[model samples]
Target: MRVLELLEEIEEIVDTAAGFPLTGKIMVDSQELLEIVREIRAELPDEIQQAQWIKNERERIIAEARTQYEAVIEDAQKQADALVENNDITVKAKLRADELMRVTENTAKQLKIGTYDYLDSILYSFQGKMEHLSSIYFGEMFTSIEKAFDDINSALAANRDELKDMAYRTQMDADDIPAPSAESEEEDQ
Candidate 1:
């Protein structure tokens, strides 16, 4: 049933019970009410388990992306280093260092572009997966919230005896007087 309908039903029960003593068994059985609460507690672990699995998956994907990105960076650095170590083997070791430097620069630029392109594609794939999983997780979360609220309402509606017990406790608390302040005590003395 909708929330409004459920609330209206509870209100009707409360109105009907106004003609009787609040401590009577006319509303809910105390043992059964306790059982409902225990059932709710038991189901809580399942909800937590679902949340933990989603969290673990998200962390694992992020870690994998970081490892891949770092590996690509290291490989690019190694290639650039190798290019710089050339000693003009074709020129009998007589060529100017500037010639070798130009070749190394061009090779490094190409390797950088290639490495970054691969990383970008990997990042895009990771982002897509994250988005899809997040949507599914959030959808389940809302359903859980709705179910929780419904369960609470259902228990409250069926257990009028529990509500009366609470009401009496509230009345007792209100009837008891608080301790006098220091100023009031001094005035009495």
Candidate 2:
């Protein structure tokens, strides 16, 4: 976000800079442009770190879900075993244990699905911002800056593709549960 703000400042400078008569060229302060570019470079790492944090948070949530699932399965098994020892209600105990396992599995799946959706939404927003920057600033006078934006855009596209692949793999593993639709995401927004 800070990078975007700095970009807006750069845009303002360009917009306000004086232009030559009969040419499409404009004058801008090189030092001012360099300072803002430095600021943007500094802010870029923070954005990347935030993306990394999202990924770590997703892993943590999945781990927590697995732990809870295991705990519940263990508890259900213990209860079923105790009931089996008393031969009178073995059938009922088996049925209850199965039900518990099914419910626990469904809960775990939902948790994982929710985590993936949350991460997808965040990456989607970030991808949009990167695209916006690439469209607005590319092909300007700053060749080095254009290359930097190009690299950032490429990285973002790769990240987005990776996320999509992850979600697809997860969906296939989860019995083909449908992924959230873009329309639904837009509605939520």
Give the number of the best model, judged by lDDT.
Answer: 2
lDDT of 1 by residue, 38-103 (tens): 554565566456556655755665566557556655655554555555655434332433444455
Candidate 2: worst-modelled 10 consecutive residues by lDDT: 138-147
lDDT of each: 0.53, 0.79
TM-score, per-candidate, Cα-based: 0.35, 0.63
- Candidate 2 Cα outliers beyond 4 Å, as residue runs: 137-189
Query: What ranges in model 1 sit over 4 Å off?
Result: 1-26, 87-189
Give the C-alpha lDDT of model 2: 0.79
Any idea how many clashes model 2 has?
0
Model 1, TM vs. native: 0.35
Q: Which ten residues in a row are the worst by lDDT in model 1?
A: 1-10
